[model samples]
Target: MDYGPVIDFHVHLPYRYKDPIAAADYLVKKLDEANVERAVVIAIEGGVESFKKRVNPKYVRNAVQEILDYVAHSPIRSIRTLIFEPDKGIDEHVQLLIEHRRRTEEVVKAVEKYPGRLYPVGSYNPDYGVDKVIERMRVYRDKLLGVKIYPTLHCISPSSSKLYKLYRFVEGINGLVIVHTGCDPGLWELPKMCRYARPKFVAEAAKKFPDIPFIIAHMGSYSAIMPGIYFREALQAYNVDNVWMDTSAVDPLFVERAVEEVGYDKILFGSDFPYLVGFTIEDSIRDILKLDISSDAKRAILHDNAERLLRMLGRL
Candidate 1:
């Protein structure tokens, strides 16, 4: 029951609030409610805007999802339904990037409001154009703890050449990188895209950016349709140093296995808050607290590891 010095490392700005100030306010309120001391908020453009259009009844989106979530965790939990969306045209991709750029700006603004309590991380994608990526991200060049890249949502390889320049930019800024690794539900579930989220691809990047820490978000174990589907890949990636893994939406069972095998030095605690629907930051925190691992590991995952990384980067 004792989770020492908690730091939720993987939260996103509240989609419900378009305003950065309101989003940060809601974030702090939720953090306080969950008893989390600090949180790292990634400004990734989420699927709420796009997914709502696909919902049969837009108003019932959350209501229906809450029920589906209940079912996903029950006795017959293994059953999952996938929503495979086809290729998005160039225009749509540009729009998504534009929105993402806007969110990055908001995150910079939000972090300015709470320096120590809230850490800022921005997002980038190829469609945003290599030039635009750096331009938009420069808004936080000196302020960011790191950048969060989504391979599945953006449909690019973890080690794509398009991202090399971005990596170099992050390196220049002395910031870390967190890459999306695992299957996301809704429009992002296309098998082609899911394949890109595998952590094996990120190993290539880790090798390329030996000086920069690369945290594989979800540790390649995040699958809304198949929980822990890529856990082996995550375990494999954990072997190399300077490449960390986060337990954002990963099952505790996998975390238990990870600790038993790899130890906890490079693991981080992240709550894919607000985006995971039907789940809360407190629930995400409890996932680690409920782990059977020793208190030392729990402290390391919940706080120490992230604290060390942030302090090492001079973000905390």
Candidate 2:
């Protein structure tokens, strides 16, 4: 299956303790080996510790540094998405606010350095109240691709009224929103969080913002059995043009179902790299190439749709 020039719409740069530039080079090498033309590099702001501990300034600092290094050394065209983890519970409001501001500043600086390569995305926690969320959105409006919300991580429903303001802001800017749907195995201890990670909530938002593009990450396949649930919910929005889904570390079975339900034009190929653990970039691409879909559909999933997105954002 010749996919032509492929674009991985979802990927994360290495952010542990390794040298940032070397980690980027390693990632670019992998992309080159797999014939990937480009990828959307997202900063991983929330993870295991995000739920349990207070925001670590050092961790945020390191993440920003990695974003800078990765974009600076990327071997192919790359779009950078600055990740944000807004304050949720009442425990550390002041600290969380400070951390969000500092992180946003760092991201803005990186975008300034790389210009076209880096795009910021805002995040909101209902706990932050709509006013503050809108304020931050306004601050980054010029640089943002859109906003990313993790209902699972923030313990908020996707359709919660708390998010309407942000959605409207995004719509007003003609931006995009990427939501994390499906089951996140890493959040096993946080069962309540997983409960809200359904595609239905996203459908509600889609109805409200008909013009803004909303991407459902993982095609709603967070866990092994729940892919059906996620896929079913996503199918409900098949007629809604602004709603799209990504093939990020999902079962190939659901990937095929998504195409069958919504068509390849709505599906974007993503590797979920580094975080995909044992799987190589080739493993990710192979999942799509081996699918029993049309050659044209496969090509669209691998490259066309993502390129369309980039062109919409003026990144191309």
Candidate 3:
């Protein structure tokens, strides 16, 4: 498609690349392959420890039941354990620590190595102590453009008080927030959790902190069971001046609707790297190019919008 000047707004470190240096190198290679000029790599820290307050007993029980419910409700062919490995970024205890440490190092190294071609974004769960999240954030403030938060995975609402301080922190630092909208896969796929990922949740935060920019990642994209139920919900965020949406792991059909509803200026291109199926970074770029919108709109989504954000964040 030759869609150049791209800025992938959502991505995460893969578990396979144990070494941060190797991971950074590999990412650059893939970016080059897809001709992506830059990427915002999300540092996803997943483990029982990552659970708010170190896994409350009630949370564990609910998680287990949710998994069971998911299994019982889904078509066997779709979610069979052998094929349904939805824990994309979660790691075991030690691995989580190592991966986080490596992820930070990787982002730093990637930026130094590629020079303005990669941006880092830290992840936060409000359930985790706000101070602890802040402590982790301070280390990356100099290097990070913003924070990516998971309401669906952590089973908390975006409007929860726990996230406000973090929002304030990001605002104080002049950083953006990437709110995961839509359904999560695997054990984390409870309707309750996914419900909070809709753009409505982000609107609450935006209303409270109008200065902080919130990008709705996935635009309330849903899993098969729900099927675009929240996508429309996400589009409603267009009313909130500080809110925007990213097209990561999102369908082209929804992207079209997003342009019509939210306008292309608020849409950002995102690959959600290491995406399932054969969805490569190139494919993600192609999806935008294939949208039934103007070339200027595609350009805005692919590069111009993200460039504006990076400039605002002082990353460019």
Candidate 4:
């Protein structure tokens, strides 16, 4: 099962704790035991707490900084993503983007501290008007490697034309997108907003934005029977060309199906992480490795796909 050069394209670093490094240490141990080579750790604003209405942007920033500091000395490569709630509409949207820009500036000033291991990903609420957000992205295109969207929580369909420009912006910047898929966890604010969990919606986006690299998170909502249906359509529609799926927050059976149907080159390994602290990220990778997919396919899923993606975006 020696999956060399494995990479995790999805993971959330727990920041709400008193010590974020403690959490990173736990993750490093897991990665070592599981033989993971590189892991992308996205910053989470809140851990097991209400993040919708009561989230403090300052708190979110501090928590992320703590996690970054912790990962600085670790063996894992931690890619930092600035997270925000897009449902806040215009004013909050402007404020969040401004803050994100500032945070990115700070990271840039401090890049030498973390070196090549750290990179930034931007995000916005598509429902508010993807065009408006792309306007913001135009300002900081150089600092961002890609953007992340949670269509379900934003109550927006990925197929909206408003997002067309946003997708174009990503392509123009040579960036990728990570999307949340499937049913929302029972969080109060999340479930209310997470209506677009269906993979078909994302598939349509992938179809439309053929040049935009999209990663469907949580294996299309971990529907045992659904990914087969959704991915089949995705493959037929996009030939699995620009679309990708991640192992984050998904069931093992769905991962197997994604590899089988979409081919391993389109699947990125991820762990929702921190939210499920002490979670076996490697266990998920191991599950995918056990699948009957060829070693090359396994290699693609574990490492090659992500490497190509990072290369495409000039992040690697």
Candidate 5:
């Protein structure tokens, strides 16, 4: 019943802030210590402000590229994504960014460089008209494998009117969608302005778009902030299919609740990684392993679910 390779599906590689390799290596060591076989790493910084204020989005590109290179030469399998920040990488005011062609080109090169090891996870601001965003997505549908959304920061609901068409487009597509759910340590000011960042909104989205595969990171935003809200979202996930939760941050209680309400089938392993505090990827997995869920469920959550998801996205 032992899942040979523990796959942490939700991990962040240091893209804009400090040293990416240092962050990657730190997680690598933790993964090695935990005997995790593979880890999926994502980059932060969607725009110029994130680049100018906090971290550089280019670092995101480099992080993915370098992580892929390391995976190619090393024994570990590192899954990487091409980040698309609608505000910075794309047009801030428009639903679709103007530099999509250039962005798509970079994504194609990155994927080609790593072959099966690298994949592009397109990001869109749902606050913009969903139709326009979907139109943009249709252009790269052939090349992209997944989609990412940040409803919280964008101050829009997952089911926002602006994103209805986008949601439909995403549901119709074959790739997976990873949503940002959790308290952002860097954006403390956001809480006052955005309330839809709550997991309930995500849960409702899951209910509305039952077919669109969704991975709610940060245990519905528990480990990071709004501890109570995380539990509610986890509880709500149980009502819908095609919606799963991840151990994106350090929320052991939320993990335990996810096991209880959604069953292990609905949980996927994750670690926010470089953005995390004192904990490492190993710590996150260890917290989940301590749950009372069965070994089969654990195996599925830790690796199998992610493996199947990756294959579905053509990354495998």
Candidate 6:
């Protein structure tokens, strides 16, 4: 199949255990090897740090140090989403906001340095109150491509009213929302929170903001687990125009089901790189090519959809 240009819609630039420049070079090398033209590079400071601490408090320092290292590195033209979590005690909440702001600034600087290569996305913990959430949104409004929310990681329901403000801002700016749906192996310690990552909540949000593009990352499946609850919900939202799904670290079987249910135009290919150890960019792209779908469908999933979306946000 001649899958034209490939675009990895999901990937991470973690600020730990690697030099940022080397990390960017490594990712670019993998993309080149896979024949991928572009990729969305998400910043993994705030969200992952919280989840890491939940798994083991010892991970906190390492997480912080890595992110700091990333900020000091040069920029690569990848989408940057600054993760934030406000669901904590007073002191902890304040500390998270401080760190999130600093990271946001770092991403902004990178975007400025790299020009068209980097796009920012804002994240907010709805529990922090709408006022604060809007305040954070304004800080990144001029520089962002959209916002990212982790309902499961923060233990907040996607349909909560608190998120509406952030959603409204994104819609007004013609931006997209990338929601973490499905279970994350890293968050295994909090299985209860994983339940909240279901795609149904995303469906509800999709219906409310019908015009805003919402990407359900991971396709609601985790680590080869078949027929995850998110898979069913994603199928349910198949008719919703703005609702889309990305195959990032998901099993191939689930990707087949997603293509079968929603068709190819709505699906996007993502590597979920760096975090999904052992899986190279080539591996991620190969997984899609190996599917039974046609050349046209594979083309859409591999590049067309993501390219269209990035163009919509003026990132292309």
TM-score of each: 0.82, 0.73, 0.84, 0.66, 0.67, 0.75
lDDT tens digits, residues 1-316, model 3?
A: 4556688888765557866667778877888898788888887644344553443435444544655655565664324431233332232323434444433445555566666777777777443567887887787677777787777655567778888888898887898888888876643455644666778988898889888889988888857666676887787876889899888888899999878876888889888887545778888888889888999999999989989988977777
Better candidate by lDDT, 2 or 4: 2
| Winner by TM-score | 3
lDDT tens string, model 2, 183-233? 653222123336677777887888887888888888777764234546677
Query: What does candidate 5's lDDT look like per residue over 1-316, in tens digits?
Result: 2336687776554433234345445556666777777665543323333323332455435433443443233321111112344235322322222222123234433334334433456666433345655676787776566566665445566756666566767656666667777544322212432355556677777777776777777765542224555557556765667777777764676677667766776677877665577776667677767777777877888888888877765557
The residue-by-residue lDDT of candidate 6 on 86-134, one tens digit each, is 1322235334434433243444444454445545555555345557756
Q: Model 4: how far is 272 from its true place, Å?
A: 2.0
Candidate 3 vs candidate 6: the TM-score winner is 3
Cα lDDT of candidate 5 equals 0.57
Compared with the true structure, all predictions reach lDDT values of 0.75, 0.65, 0.73, 0.57, 0.57, 0.65
For each predicted model, how many residue pairs clash, with residues at least 3 apart or on different chains? 0, 1, 1, 1, 4, 3
The segments of candidate 6 whose C-alpha lies over 4 angstroms from its true place after superposition are: 1-3, 17-26, 45-102, 126-130, 186-191, 223-227
Q: Which wins on TM-score, candidate 3 or candidate 5?
A: 3
TM-score comparison, 1 vs 5, better candidate = 1
**Candidate 1, 1-316: lDDT as tens digits:** 6555589889988767778899889989999989889998887754333333432332233323444554344343112222111223223433544554436777889878887898888877444656787888886688888788787666567688888898999998889989888877543433444678888888888988898899989877776556776789888987777889999878789889999999999999999887778999988888788889998898899989999998888775
Candidate 6 lDDT for residue 166: 78
Instruction: Provide the lDDT at 161 for model 6.
Output: 81
- Comparison by TM-score, 2 against 3, better one: 3
Model 4 C-alpha lDDT per residue in residues 182-202, reported as the tens digit of each score: 644222112223446556677
Per-model RMSD to reference: 6.8, 11.1, 4.2, 11.5, 12.1, 9.9
